[model samples]
Target chain A: MKIAFTAKGTDWDSQMDPRFGRTEYILVYDDEKETFESFDNRDIENEAHGAGPKTSQKLFELGAQVLITGNGPGGNAATVLQKAGVKSFIGAGGMNVKEAYKAYKNNELKEF
Target chain B: MKEIVIISGKGGTGKTSYTASISVLAGKDAIVADCDVDAADMHLLMKPVVEKSENFYSGVVAEIDPDKCTNCGICTEKCRFNAIPVINDQHIISSLNCEGCGYCEKVCPVEAIQMNEMNVGDWYISNTKVDNTMVHARLGIGAENSGKLVAKVKNEAKQLAEETNKHYIIVDGSPGIGCPVVSSLSGANYVVLVTEPSVSGLHDLKRVYELVDKFNLKAGCIINKSDINPEVTNEILDFLKKESIEHIVSLPYNENFTKAMTNGQTIVEYDQGELRDAIVQSWEKVKELVEE
Candidate 1:
């Protein structure tokens, strides 16, 4: 399934990867043949608030089934994700992208 | 009679410290307005005991009543902001995405959508230890209408200055050239652009200076941590001269700034050092310019 991972707070960028530090959105697209593709949030700049709801909307538009991230979904952001039928998982910090997807697929993770 | 606004294009540029120190140095002769409504830190240093506080309601947010609603897709179609969505056979409104345009309520065929007033933030008028009227506010998290809240704070500060017959008002403005910054610069007599010596600092400073110039307000520049990168500092000074903007002062990199921040005080109050003197000199030049 296609998924999007959002980094929470400010410090994780230096910890995970320097490029991820300033990125507002990371898109993981899955194909029917079990292949994966990644896209950066910078690809979409025309939308309002840049990476807030528009990122999630773009992921939903791309048919992303799961979202992996480091921060808890709260405020209006959580509501938007819920409405879009996107499954959000929190506490995914320190985990590699592949491991996060594995845990999510096995239903070991909880929704935010 | 004149107002001076202090703003840094980026956060953590010691905008609040300089503003607080200027307020302290200016003493009772000036009224201070903390216009960084989103994350106002001036109060931490100013130590204002709020003499009066009032709730500010900017506008209404649309609320969806699930009980009275049909699982109508009409609301979603009508919403231009994508604020209304259909989930689990239920129609819901995302409060964060809602612009409070009231379009959702008007387009609801079943009358299930209603607009309710929300308390977005609070504004205050207080007495600081420096013996000046301090006006400030806090914007609710994920809240919109910060520009209006800033405008409200400035209006209150102006009113307070008038009531007390104070001639000058010092405003600590928010970062960036967004709506709140514009609101802070709307009626200002002068603007002090606080900048650092970093590349990003100069970039954002130029952006903010353009904004200040757009409003036709006279502006001056102060380079904080100028010694961190003297080459860049010199470049900034040259740019200032080329642009015909006044270079009020350049403060060297000093640990005293962080130390003062840790102690919840301004550099002037923390240590009577060269940094403090530079800030004082900058304030004096600003005073002279505003008076001119």
Candidate 2:
């Protein structure tokens, strides 16, 4: 299963972004491939409205089974993701992307 | 020709009703622009007849072609928005989650992804009961770019005013200090700020005043339902005095305002009473100040 993290940087040591929609980058950890991929996500800021929905759409397209981030998605986006059976793990507030992934793997993150 | 915006810092502060009355008082020579695209209601009272309309497109969303015979899920893997979800072993694009960023189109190996334009809203040009044209818009639910829509409404109103040689552009501006409100303030010559005497009303008034002051637009205040609390009314008066804003008029609490709204009429149209006189008096003041 693929997992996603809203990250501040492109590297494994980067801190988790506090915002779901306005994150600098979306970092994906492919547990199956043991690989790290970073997608630049600052373009969402250019949108005048529905940034949350757009970001949620991006994650859905990424095939992210789980989202590990500091902040929760907005109401509409949360509803869409929840309906799609994509689980969220949010206690990665100050943790780096790698640490957030570890927390998910060790069952240390809080489920929304 | 002058452009005066009617605004309120909070909802239900009589902004729309007063703007309707002002439009009537301004008559056929005024071209009106309902800049509150998010929740436009001025057209309701004016009973506008649409003469022209155009669809507003704001963004794009990506779609997937499932017949490519490759359920490799690579498109889903690269999408930044959680737009694609797999169910029943079939992948689909959830438009709500799609940001239209086009990342999926680039990463798809099967050439199955296509970008489609998003229709965000519609804007209208209509002739109102007042014999002048009104520009208004309705934004689609979950649509982005409302500020741009407001700008579009204003631009259309301005062009209409120039084309018809009208003397005023009466704008019913949106109720906050956000992007829509900012767009309304761009070329405004003056502002008729509507407010109440309640504590929350006063709080919002000050915040809105800061924005008006920053833009340096000439402004006047109208205190609706001023009799609800005398102390707060005095506090509002003091605040207005400190800000050097004209106290255009203070209207007493009356059910007639609500009656006009329920009956789909302006207070000036519903009754030829003291309320109508007060509005007429302030409108003359608005003319004086705009000219000054």
Candidate 3:
């Protein structure tokens, strides 16, 4: 399964983003391939409405089955993720991408 | 026909009361459009008898058929609004959360999802007790498209005015510089901003004026309850003069306004004193400015 993390940067040491829709970057982790890919999300800042749904669409197209972020998406975006059949875990705001991944493995993150 | 919109950036600044009196003063020559769909109160004073009523449809919402039998959860995964939620292992659509985007209907594989038109509100054309036409609307509970509803009321009022050969359409606009307010200002020939001599009132007036300025529309100012705060009132007068906004009138704080409301009579009908004369003069000035 692929996991996505909202992050401040492109690397594993980048701090996790707390916001879902306006996150700076969406970093994807492929468990089977052991590879990481990052998608820039800064362009969503200009969206006046449906920022959540826009970001969720990006996450859905990224083929990420699991989302590990700080605070989860808002109602609209959350609906998108719920429909996309993607599982989301929040409360990873203060942690870096690597720490958030470890916490996800340890079941320390809260299911959103 | 000319359209004149009366708006108060802050609530309880006498927009409705002022509008009621203006309707009475303008009489048969004007038709009133109450665009405050959030909490329509002009009906209380107008006492409109419904002449015609129509259902207002706006946007669309997705509905899921549980009998289709696939718990595959595709609808929930694709819905951007998160309107569909799993309840008792069955996907149910929440009408309130739905934005009527129809994306889920397109993505649903079993064709279980159907998009349905949402009836968000109702608009009415009525004959007021004062014997003039009044166009108003009532938004359904949890409805968010108040701007569309306001536009409906304005368009209907304008059509009614044109049919009846009325010279003006007087609009009672909603508070704040939001969507509904913008809709009210659209195509209006003139704007009458009712304000009080208070800090927040002045602040909101500036914000609302910024919005009006964007539409490049002419505006006049009515300083209601000017005596409540002389210093702030003077400051407001200075701002009006600097902006070249016409000073329509300055009404003092009076309990007669409350009395007139309680009696279900407009200030023009209840008060035959100087207060009534000022309101009548204000209406005349508004008519003259709108005509110009």
The DockQ values of the predictions, listed in order, are: 0.01, 0.05, 0.01
- The top-ranked prediction according to lDDT is 3
Report, to 2 decimal places, the DockQ of model 3. Answer: 0.01
Tell me how many clashing residue pairs each candidate has. 1, 19, 6
Best DockQ goes to which candidate?
A: 2
In candidate 1, stretches whose alpha carbon ends up further than 4 angstroms from where it belongs are A1-112, B80-82, B85-90
**lDDT (Cα, tens digit) per residue for candidate 1, span B145-262:** 3555776787678768878899889999988877567667755678898899999999888888877764455789989988899888988998899888899988888899889888
- Which stretches of model 3 miss by more than 4 angstroms? A1-112
Q: Model 3: clashing residue pairs?
A: A79-B82, A83-B76, A83-B77, A83-B78, A84-B77, B60-B100
- Give native contacts recovered, as a fraction, per prediction: 0.00, 0.11, 0.00
Ranking, TM-score, top scorer first: 3, 2, 1
TM-score of each: 0.69, 0.70, 0.71
Per-residue lDDT over A4-100 for candidate 1, one digit per residue giving the tens place of the 0 to 100 score: 6553222223211111112344646464556555555544322222234555666677676777764443234456777888887754544555665
- How large an RMSD does model 3 have? 17.3
lDDT of each: 0.74, 0.83, 0.85
Q: In TM-score terms, which candidate is top?
A: 3
Categorize the docking of model 3.
incorrect
Minimal lDDT window, size 10, model 1 chain B:
B143-152
